[model samples]
Target chain A: MTLRGKAAIVSYGETPVTRARKDKGEPRLSYWEYFAWATSLALKKAGMTTKDLDGQGLAVMHPEVDHSLFLGVEVAEMLGVTSKWIITPSHGGASGCVGLAQAALAVSSGIVDRVLCVIGDAPMTYGDTMMLTEHRRDFEKPFGVMGPTSLFALVMRRHMEQYGTKVEHTGKIAVTQREHAVLNPDAVFKERFTMEDYLNSRMIAEPIRLLDTVMRVNGGSAFIVTKTEEAKRWTDKPVYLLGYGECNNYHHGSKALSDATLMGIGQASREALSMAGLEPRDMNFFQPYDDFTIAVLMQIEAAGFCEVGKGGKFIEETDLSYRGSIPLNTGGGQISAGQPGLAGGNLNLVEGVRQLRGEGEGRQIQGAKAGMVTGIGAVQYGRNVGYNSVAVLGSEL
Target chain B: MSRFGVKEGGEARKPLPYITNYSQGFWEGTKAGELRIQKCNACSHKQWIPKAACEECGSIDLSWIKSGGKGKVYSYSIIRHVVMNSMAFEKEIPYALALIDLDDGVRVVGQVVECKPEDVKIGMEVEAFFEDIGGASIFKFRPRR
Candidate 1:
């Protein structure tokens, strides 16, 4: 009934992160191509081929793409693999972790032996801006409630009012993550930024500056999940899925429930940690989704890293750098590394897996045995994220 | 000037929500200067933004009821820069967007007009006001004085 310790991620892969491809001169891949490239890399690393995959899960790339073929069926046909179980998750930023959790269930339930979960997107290629406004196209767009920046701005402002959180606290996250990005060769923005620079950045939405938001870029990431008993046959360094949880408290455009300060990540985190038989302190590192710095702060509080309304203080007093006390987003998160459309959530999930596998070359947390990754999705009423997913991963079973 | 030149008679080009059958009542109510929200008869739960069935008790028996339209500002944001490239809102550099928890217990999102962006704050009392833009009734909020 529970996926805990039953499935393991044997290998993971990612295409190079890039801003855009103006022409063939650049080494940018298409949305589908990025998925293929990452899948091939993961399969190779797992010492297997597409033929070995009996289950597949993919995240829908963009809304403009033709859904007549259905992403799930298209991917299976393109990969030349016949999957008995297939799904195309569309939970926005939470799709990656949601897909991974679903795949874990599929493999653990004896429905499939090997499951491949992938998410990728070329936002620059598709000209995809924050698409959450599409939820209520007419109602939100006319009023200029356009993107995630404004939505998160509202959340940040509310947080400030209730908790006395200031820009300095969030600036700390941006500054610290920039520092982490310097050590990550794959990071899009490797240049370090100071708190002053973050504070001085142009405001995209009031209470949310440019530095606090994630950059839209082109990339894809993937991982292979299999039964824990069969994981040893693929790789020696397998990261087991300790536990996972997902929650969608409200549907898009629904205003029945409104709590800007609470992103519903607490429920998901609590469920995951309880299932994993772990506590917040048990995490050697954290990879909370970082579409915005405020999101990370809220998740930290919701996940019980600190008490509610104390996230700002926690950020101020805690060290989030790679070698710091609480290693966070060691790969610079989506803020510095660039968000690849719906694949943004994978940026956190994959980084957690890599750290647990001892693969973080420069930003490795010493003796990291477990890590927590989180994802947020679907802005409610074009204001706040309403869905959350969290997973606990461990290096040892 | 209409709040940062965002609206000018009928020349403002902005995206508008298409009036569908399920939402026609809400739109019509706005045009008539009345705030309407769906109420589930089974559990008496109020809903906003118009949906097919009751979100609370999963009942399709719902009725459109007039709302008091008076509530406190639950949260708010000020748009310093426009994310969407709409000509109508391009010049609206700073506008207050607010979430209001209606007296009927349903939250609604609307722009806060007739006030400076900085004047908006959480817990501030507000009331819904309908604005007619090019034949479309768009609901907005204003600080209750």
Candidate 2:
């Protein structure tokens, strides 16, 4: 009943992160163009073409003018190909990873042989992000609580209060990720920063500083997934999805939700690892969504890399650099690499694939055979992320 | 439903709480200088904001019940930068917004006033107060003295 290794990710492609604007005379890309480039690059990397894709899915987390009524169909049409199944996932930041899971299901279940999982967002280039975020939220807008920064800040403060997690511990995450980013030429932020720089960074929301937040950028990433039998034809090393799990609205505003530091990632991660027949120790690396430094800290605890309420100590003792044990966000993550809207999930997901495929050059986790990529996003503004997904990937069975 | 767009003068007034028919009951209670929570009569389940059905049970027999307007600070964040309308919240530059765990067991978000931003702490006792702004009764919390 398990889809363990039934489907393999044959290739991954990502465009350089950019804030290019037509106004600044820099070349810019819409989500449409980004999707095209991302998917085509993935196919070309596998020595295949659009003709090989029998399933199509797009991850468009935020509203964009380029989005159509029928997203999957439009994506296929744009690629000038026909697909057996078309999928569009709306899991916020988890959208692209959810799309990958759906693509995996379609391929593993024999509904489709090869599926193209594409994700792109041009919020910076198009400026449609503010239009979508500002107008709605009858419940959210009035309180002067802006966006994720404000919302997550409460969670960060709660963590510090309840668990004694401190700025010194959380700031390490940004410092380590920036170090990894310095080695990644495609990373948006090239310069490395230290704990001192992190502390000195301007505070947007108390406890959540300028460095703790993910920078929004425009970019695209894609993966080509196929049944293992067909996957070998495309690449010598096909990264296999061993397991995955998702949960939403856990303990929603119930008495239990009063604890702002709580997250559903614990349940999701347990299910994924159990399905993979692996433990957290088996992962060669970890790459959870880093919309904020606190997010990565919370995931580290929820994913069982450390004990709950002990993330501070775990972070203090652990080496998070790319060359260190338990390598994390080797490609700089969304915090260091500019988050491309909800495509932020894809940035981590694709990085996991590239590392598994041994494609990570300068920032590669050496001898990395397996890793976990997690997706977390704001399903609602009230209490942390609503949807959390975990994917366990490996280079072999 | 109350008007949602920018008020006639635009940003001169504080933003109004988003009021829909589903949540009109809660707003009405707030306007009457009371804090009410949605309670499922069948399951005795308590909820916040407003929803059509009981979150715990499928009961539609939901009614507005008065809350003690007292809660403990579940969490709080000091907003140093303004992301909403500057005209509305700019002067208030750094303020403490909190998620309050109501004594009734439901959680809600409101700004914590009458205290320094740094003084806001988890488990701090607070009580709800209404702010009359732009003809809307906005619920905010202050240190319960």
Candidate 3:
């Protein structure tokens, strides 16, 4: 289905990313605590209470412990609403986008007029390092390949070999992202970073410097999806979903990931532009996932927003600072901004919505009529998880 | 069995349960300090980071195949720092990370150790050496024998 002229993001909400090692006087703040905080904030921002929710969608990883908890059902009972739809989706790191995409379809299809999508946790629980080892095959885990940093380092090794891209080139991305973070009041890392700071940072994985990797965070984030008519009922400004696409290629740590040029985002971006009847030049901002600095380079290139391997050049030559040139990752991204897993993913979407609605407090992208948000999933620290999802969002229905 | 128990035949080696599923073969090879990969019997495709299924054809027919354990370095990085504590690395910053293309058509990324980080180069011949870290033999690439 074209899914054109259908659904819009009426309200976006999130608890500012925080590091809660332990839930304030609660049991370890399991996934449920984070989910509740995020969902409640989103509903409040939409000018609704949990009681106003008509439907719900649960997005998360860890099917073993997380899936059957019936979070959507739990929320419905809390609100005393007869939910018309309840969904639980597992898409690894891209779970938040998966939830939003599902919410758009639910609203557009009239399955639900409004839906809640959320995720978050304490980083120490399932940080990137543990996920790599815990989810890894026992055979491979023993080789001491215990983290994504080394796995990504593996991929960076090949890219630098093939493209002659220097570590300094990748360092520029960290330096610039930190600069943007300085302007973000809510960003976890507001410290100013010079290229020297990036260069001097310790190495976590070969090509992935300490600054290049995103730190774990404890927090929650959420989004509320509703129909265009319903969005008008709740708020005047509604960010519409224009286009989306997803692809998977799970090579693990074996081969050089195809489309390493970071052009995969373009695949979904193309579909979005086609759906919205728009073009790259028409976009006012871009929010490519910044789990790792190199991943951003790959995503922007994949989105065709810039040339192949020229992501470094684009960030270096142009002023991506607020109101300088085109604004990219104005939220400071997962790199400089805190990445609370699912919450971090929603942070990008929330920033896109905030900018589109002109509510961004200080780091607003000026004249932002339309925006694009993309997510990369399943990539171990260095290897491609071989999955990509992109969404094009706009101010009009 | 305990990971600390020493093996009878090998050089005071302990009984470490190799990683199962796709990586069991890889870990077993490292214990012997010899690198190997699973080759798809159906498609003749060479695999690294061993998997139970073939990546190209999705076939389950696979066999443990030994590698020449020698390859050309495709690319490399000089590590200037270490975030996690390390006893193996004596230096402060500079280290080499290289992508080595095995003769079997499989390439893997690993640290190029036992030499000055600056001495590493692309296209240089290198071989695999097993480094014992915390009772487990980890794979690291080095200059050719």
- Candidate 3's residue-wise lDDT over A210-326, tens digit each? 899887676777777777777888888888888777665533333432323343455667777788788777878888777787777667666776776666667667766667666
Say which prediction, candidate 1 or candidate 3, comes out ahead on DockQ. 1
For candidate 1, list the clashing residue pairs, or say none: A138-B16, A138-B17
When summed lDDT is taken over every stretch of 10 residues in candidate 2 chain B, the lowest stretch is B1-10
Instruction: Score chain B of each candidate by TM-score.
Output: 0.88, 0.88, 0.77
TM-score of chain A of each: 0.94, 0.95, 0.88
**Total backbone clashes of candidate 1, pairs 3 or more residues apart or in separate chains:** 2
Tell me the tens digit of each residue's lDDT in model 2 across A1-397: 7878888989888887787866778677788888888877888899987766644433334333346667667777788887767777767777766877888888778777877788777878765453334223555656667667888888889889888999999899999999888888888898988799899999999989999998888888888888888888999999998988888776634543445677888898998999999999999999998899999999999999999899999999999887777888988999888888767778988889989888889888888998899988673445767889999999998
Off by over 4 Å in 1: A21-24, A54-69, A128-135, A250-257, B1-12
Better of 1 and 2 by DockQ: 1
DockQ each: 0.57, 0.54, 0.27
Once model 1 is optimally superposed onto the true structure by TM-score, how far is the C-alpha of residue A85 displaced, in angstroms?
1.4
